[model samples]
Target: KNKYALQLDLVKDLEEAEARLAEVEQKLDPVGDYVEASMIAAASAQFHNVVAQLRILNPNVEFVEDGLDEDKE
Candidate 1:
């Protein structure tokens, strides 16, 4: 298997899921909203699920945001 390919594919999923999660998290009032809070919770769960999947694919591989995270590599 191509490790780069695996990483590339899942990183995209992680990014998308994280984007959705962050969007809802930033826009919603977690303490005052119920339905919107559920949406945030769902998105958050999805983001973590993708991270779990990536780790399962390769426990030693590191996950990073392509354009958003600090680079030392």
Candidate 2:
């Protein structure tokens, strides 16, 4: 029981760490359309990779899509 509790605590810590990292990343580089578009794109790609890894680690998770317009499609 103690071991299970410790494991849950560790998982919570990891989740918090990931959220903090993401927040820092966003603060450091505010998203916009400018010369830094390439940098933003790279950062976004890296962020997606990290998120994918997290999804794999946590099986009971679903990723949501953004900007889905039926007319555009």
Q: Each model's TM-score?
A: 0.41, 0.41
Q: Mind sharing the TM-score for model 2?
A: 0.41
TM-score of 1: 0.41
- The clash tally of candidate 1 reads 0
Per-residue error at 61 for model 1, in Å? 0.9
* Residue range 1-73, candidate 2, lDDT tens digits: 6999999999999999999987877877667445377766677787778878988998897866464212241
Candidate 1 lDDT over 1-73, as tens digits, reads: 6999999999999999999997887677556577665777787777778877988998999887455422225
State the displacement of the C-alpha of residue 3, model 2, in Å, after optimal TM-score superposition: 1.1
Off by over 4 Å in 2: 32-73
Q: Which residue runs of candidate 1 sit more than 4 Å off their true CA positions?
A: 1-32, 65-73
lDDT scores of the candidates, listed in order: 0.76, 0.75
The positional error of residue 23 in candidate 1, measured at the CA in angstroms, is: 27
